[model samples]
Target: MTLTRRDRLVVDARAIVALGGPLLGNNLSITGMAFADTVMAGQLGAVDLGGLAIGAASFNLFMFLGFGLLMATSPSVAHAFGANDARKVTAYARQSWWLVLGLAVLLFTGMRQADWFLPAIGISEDVLPVAVGYVHAISWGMPALLAYFSLRYTSEGLGRTKPIMFTGFLGLTVNVIGNWIFMYGKLGAPALGAVGCGVATAISLWLMFFALLLHVRTHRAYRPFDFFARIDPPNWPVLAELTRIGAPIAGSILAEGGLFVAAALMMGGMGAVTAAGHQIALNYAAFMFMVPLAISSATTIHVGHTLGRGDVAGARDVGWIGIGMCAIVMTISAIVILLCNDQIAALYTRDVPVRELAATLLLMAALFQFSDGVQVGAAGALRGFKDTTIPMALCVFSYWVVGFTFAYYFGVYRGEGPVLVWIGLNVGLTISAVLLVARYQLVTKTRLGAAVQRPI
Candidate 1:
């Protein structure tokens, strides 16, 4: 049965959605934890929210870099699973634990040192104490959070995202209650403020890790690999392979994420009002970004599966399908932001000044939605092919060379403010989208030609 292009697109799109739907829920729920923190902290006052903005920016920069490093597990596991290599799958999964531990330890240590550097970075005296406290409190959960992602990404590669989704919702529930109890002084506890948000998040992370751990250990679907059979000593060679693939991904994430974190810090220098406003806008934009990010992740696994089975054409089809879906979805996202920017900002803060500034920044956020979607989508597809090195280089150039330069010039050098800073973000994302799409096209064409030339 020869399927036409439209038929093939439909089939592939269905596969991506099937995989991405649970992931979307999971991503949304995960992002909701941050949203909850932002909203809850806003109630305390602009100072607390602004402090949180700095703390979160610092923590997320490290956390998301770890996320990219562990992301290698998904495509690696997917490729093994696709090839019916159960041993390889288990091996990769087990080795990932070592990687997770190293990342957790390093990040934890780095987070605790925030007190030393944040002060030097121009954070206001009022905000500095809050930021440091938040980081110190949150650092306690680094191990558990990284471990949870190990299991979650492994499940994602195995095409078992529902468990991950369920865990995310559970984490969100626990976090919200904990925030109320700790942040509001409920049940006789001290109102810990921004620090309480960190404490709650840390507790939720550990619980989520345990919940996912239990499911993976007991589920029959995962029984074949016997993942919990025993903890093997660190396999140096396998660990090396994982690092080889993941390091570039970490670099890529850091380059892109660092730009935003830097922007947040720069905003902190301007004043609490500006910082709070920027955080509100950036947080919502990040929340929306998760939609396409989930889709991009699903695309990575799907494309990996196809390629692992040696179906180059299928891999190409699914990759393009995923990218197109991201673009369309983000277009709708942009429209929503344009129509209700103020309403959206109001959800974050009650302060009129903060709300007004945030709404203006969101308009800029809307301008970049298409570019953000396209870049991440293409990056996801590229990951499926274990093609991280070039993409990493490209991301660095796009984010740091292009994005950071422009942001610093317009926002700082010219003293134009955060709106122009956001415009810089748009330009960088747009360049990335164009470059990555071109890369995907070239790589696929080359791979297809190679497949054609090889005699069976």
Candidate 2:
């Protein structure tokens, strides 16, 4: 935490340079889609927006697993490449695909059964139809979405993120066009209204998937292994390794995703206005989270590579550099929120009450950025070490036991409103961040000491 001590973390500048740009770029584009999705949905009507929020919150719970499982792809690939094991990389990639796809089928089925899902989540009667429609329509995108995550993770594992950046841009464009065409009946399409948002999401997903596939086809780094080439037979031992590393990662995301899903369910019990306001805040947070989330990807790759090269100090450097970069990025973004909190809220709505509620909610979100940023960075550090299981247990206690408990008491029980709930949310994230940092510091020091004593 000291200035000079922090300065000592500069051992891996080239690795930082290699990672920082692509991860930040990818995060920004992904954030744009998140922003656009909420803005577009909110613009439709309060009812529609509330429904979209509910549906998305529910889906995110499962998506945490689907996405986390993709983590199985990257670190192993990085480790394999670092060890000069080309065969291992191919083997891990192929198995990671199968692992994530099985998860996707489960998710697709669950979404198809989302009608029962609504009532379980305590969705209000009037908003039920909109929520149901969004869930079902968006359900169709799950397979494409999983495919995209798998491919992207594969690329990142190989120390390539720029291809995904190109695809992300393509996704953003496709999303905007689809939203315009389907939402308002532009381009000779019928005005599908709120449901159109779901359609737009589906189309954007496919566009991103195919665009990346095309890139991989022609890019020299990826060209040697034609899809037609006989890939390594699926390796169960490798699958086991991936699962061991990723299950906890999945659990951690599930816990965090539960925050939104649980909030929506509780808000639905309250009213549409509350649900809509929650969505606005959540949409914004999701955008910001991409920074640390993307950094986690880089941390995993960089750390695995360093470890493979038997450079313990260098691996530690990658983790610290990632942490520093995330702090800077998130802190700068946080300033924008603190200063113009009200202005940003108003953009979400013309309704005075919704605007007021959103602005007040932003206050709860403001200072919490530091905690959220650091916690995500710590999580990234763990991923770099291929450590997920302990974090998963930590998340369960922090998020479900402490986080949801506080949210219920502060937001629901107190009826002291969203501000209290938001404050509680911050408390939960901060706690998680602190614990994760402490654990990582101890572990990193141990690794560094052992490396120093070894006969190099």
Candidate 3:
């Protein structure tokens, strides 16, 4: 029953699409919540939108660290599942809960104290109160958010992505409703404006977490994993192992996310109009990025599974296909952004200056879509191979050393504007794409060579 190369390619494509489809939906849903928050907050006023941007940037800094740590569960679980090591899979899943608890507490404390550092970062007086309120409200959800990540990553590793998709939509629905109710002070609740957006987001996180927990508890498909069959205490060695693998991942994610956070903070100092405009452009770019992000996630799972089955060639093929898919899709997205820049900008706000600035930035955003997609795809492939430390170093070099230096020169020192800042982002993403793709190639070639030389 040996299949032809064409048949195998078709099968690989099908597998990637099957895994990526729901992941795409899930990613989009999550980003949609952010999009909603931005749009709703924008309606309140430019100052409110600026505050949302700063608060969200700060929140995401801590959140990405927790997310990267929890993400260790995915590749570990995928490798175990592919190797048919059910005990190992359950062990990794259980240990992730411990990691989640630790991260939740740490992030919660940091988020609560976020306001103390706002003035140091140059957040304006008018925006500071709103940003503080937003962070404080959202801080309550750190536990739920980390818990959801642990469960979601475990499910993703098992190739059960539909639950994530379903829960994501459910979360989005709840977020919108909560925002309407709380932000506008519907039904006797006091109107809290931008702060209410954080409240809504926090509530949605808890809802999603509990929903996934209930599903894992009762679903027959998850019965074998025994996610709830026994209570396991914290295991330091296993926790350490997870952290060892995850720390570099966290660093890499922080490097990329930090670049954006820095840009947001820099824009904050520029003024409310500039900051609001930047948020609009960045939010749309993030929305479009979900497509490639989902492809990247699927690539990691596919590559890990293939490697676990001792198929190095198959893993390499999957990686390339995933990267190719991302490139092609992003090219199309870039075209769309170029074509509808004004129309898209108009969707976010009515302020003439903000709209004009955002529209201009969207043009620059189009230029970087391909680079963004390629780098994320390559990073995902590397993760599947359990090679992260080098990638982390590469990201830090690309983003901070190369990207920020240029951004500061053009945007801040020169006082050019948000457009020049986006140019820096494009440069960073392009450099990351080149280096990360090369790294993936080198890693795969070495692995393939080793696999061939081994005695069979």
Q: Considering TM-score, which of the candidate structures 1 and 2 is the better prediction for this target?
A: 1
lDDT of 2 by residue, 1-456 (tens): 544644655646556556756866777786687677778877777887788777777667767778888877888888877887777777777777778668888988988887896887568986788778877877888888888888888788788888888888887788878888887899799887767777887888888888887777678897543442665566788888999998888888888777757876888777778888887877776787787777766787888888878877778877877777777777887898899988888777776776777777777777778788887888888887887888888877887888888998988898877766776677778788888888788889998898788885
Q: After superposition, which runs of candidate 3 have C-alpha atoms over 4 Å from their true positions?
A: none
Model 3: how far residue 133 lies from native, Å: 0.8
lDDT of 3 by residue, 111-230 (tens): 999769888888877788888899999999889999999999899888889999999999999999989988899989989998999999999999999999999889998889887878
| TM-score of decoy 2 | 0.94
Model 3 residue pairs with clashes: none
| C-alpha positional error of residue 402 in candidate 3 after TM-score superposition, expressed in Å | 0.6
TM-score of every candidate relative to the true structure: 0.98, 0.94, 0.99
lDDT of 1 by residue, 1-456 (tens): 999989988998999999999999988988899999999999988999999999999998889778888989999999999999999899999999988888888999999899998998889887889999999888898899899989998998998989998999999999999899988899999999988999999999999999999999998999999998998899988888888888898888898888899999989988899999999999999999999998999999999899989999889989999999999999999999999999999999899999999999999999999999999999999999888999999998998899989999999899998987888888888999999999999999999899989999
Residue 234, candidate 3: Cα error in Å is 3.0
